[model samples]
Target: MKTADPALQAMLRERNLRIIMPIASILAALGLWEFLVWYNDVPHYLIPAPSLIAKTLIQDWATLAQSAWFTVKLTLLSLSLAIAGGVLLGMLFALSRTVEISLFPFAVILQVTPVVAIAPLILIYVESTFWALLICAWIVAFFPILSNTAIGLRSADHNLRDMFRLYQATPWQRLRYLLIPSALPYFMAALKIAGGLALIGAVVAEFVAGTAGQNTGLASRILESSFRNEIPRMFAALFLVSVLGIIIFLTTSWLSRAVLGHWHESEIKREL
Candidate 1:
């Protein structure tokens, strides 16, 4: 058998070390969690053991899974709409200083406004809870994308801008070539941020407005479990939500690397 080079072996060892630490950390935390519950003899209602949480999750898999699906659907839908709308608005802002100055204050207002505070009024005005939830999530998710993308669009090299103008590039061409590429990294970063915000918004809205249609989300289930003092089930749902958020964050982060890998400094760090 051919021996691996020392440098390659060292790199492999380092990679494995990096992977092991997080896994070790998680296991240690879970072990500590289990110990605390056992040590305190914590009541099941107060703090369910990890074993109980797993059992509850399995026992209620059907209902929990359905609710999980609903929450995922709402999150995905809201994120899609936010990305589409935010990118367009960001472009508008980047292209016209006056338009940006006029409209940005409202965006800021939307950003600063708490979804919990807004959900009730939105539910009152909007005939359907679904629409209201969508709006609320969009409100929370859109601003980062819009603001980051606007900054990115404006970040294109001034020389390139001058060249485009000299070439008599059409507005669309300028946007497609100069602005879009320049803005992509910022947009992806915004997307990563927005993914978590979208989930939070959906859950918060559901918590406030309750469920509308046949499909109630995990947030509703969480609230229900909390009210009834179903501690294990609550922990299970909360765990799933936490998992979902982590997955979104990691997935977006991966996508950002995949798309901007060739151009961005963040991705290039690995090369050095």
Candidate 2:
């Protein structure tokens, strides 16, 4: 059999590094953490070993599962609202320069404002806990989608727009045929970012609202764990949060690849 080309070999090596290195690093860190806890005889309340954290997660699965489900609900709903609002607003702005100029500054202000500072005020006035959390998460997630989609709409091919004008294409025709495809990559990019931000916003809102019992999210569980000095359980809640973030990232990344891999160079196979 013919040998693989040197370039293919290099690509394989790079791909292996990409996959293997991170796993190796995580395992090494976990091993070190476990060893340190064991060697130093550190109490579980101080710094629980990775194994202890895992045990806590397994033992508290019922409570943690409920908390995780609540958090997931918040994240997904906020992201969905952000997507709908952002895309519609972006398209409207793309069509009307005057409207964009007038309304865009307000969007910028919302984006720049810290959600933490605003969350307490929102909770105070919102009247409903769920809506308050949703609003806070929506606020965090909305702007990236809006800005990226707006920029992407504007980034559509000028020459194509002129040709469409010459042919007297309708607004819908222009959007469907020319602009939407151009804006897709930007929209997907924003979606990936918004996913993480939505999770963070939901958790932060939960922390600020500080409600407990059946209606609570993972942040509440974390707070409860901290107050009770259940350090391993706190770590377990944190672990779930990190895992959720990873899942969001992976899901968005896969969505991006699925949509754009065939045509977009960013998603296409690289030579180097």
The clash numbers for all candidates, in the given order, read 0, 0
Per-residue accuracy of model 1 over 21-78 as CA lDDT, tens digit each: 9999989988899999999899999889888999999999999999999889899999
Give residue 64's lDDT in candidate 1 (0 to 100): 96
For all predicted structures, in order, the TM-scores are: 0.94, 0.93
- For every candidate structure, what is the RMSD over all alpha carbons to the true structure, in angstroms? 1.6, 1.9
Clashing pairs in 2: none
* Model 2 agreement with the true structure over 1-272: per-residue lDDT tens digits: 99999988988999999999999999999999999999999999999999999999999999999999999999999999999999999988988999899999999888899999999999889898989999999999999999999999989888998999999999889989989999999999999999999999999999998854467889999999998999999999999999999999999999999999999988999654
Q: List the residue pairs that clash in candidate 1.
A: none
**How many backbone clashes are present in model 2?**
0
Task: Pick the lDDT winner.
Answer: 2
> lDDT of all the models against the reference?
0.91, 0.94
Task: Please report the candidate that would top TM-score against the real structure.
Answer: 1
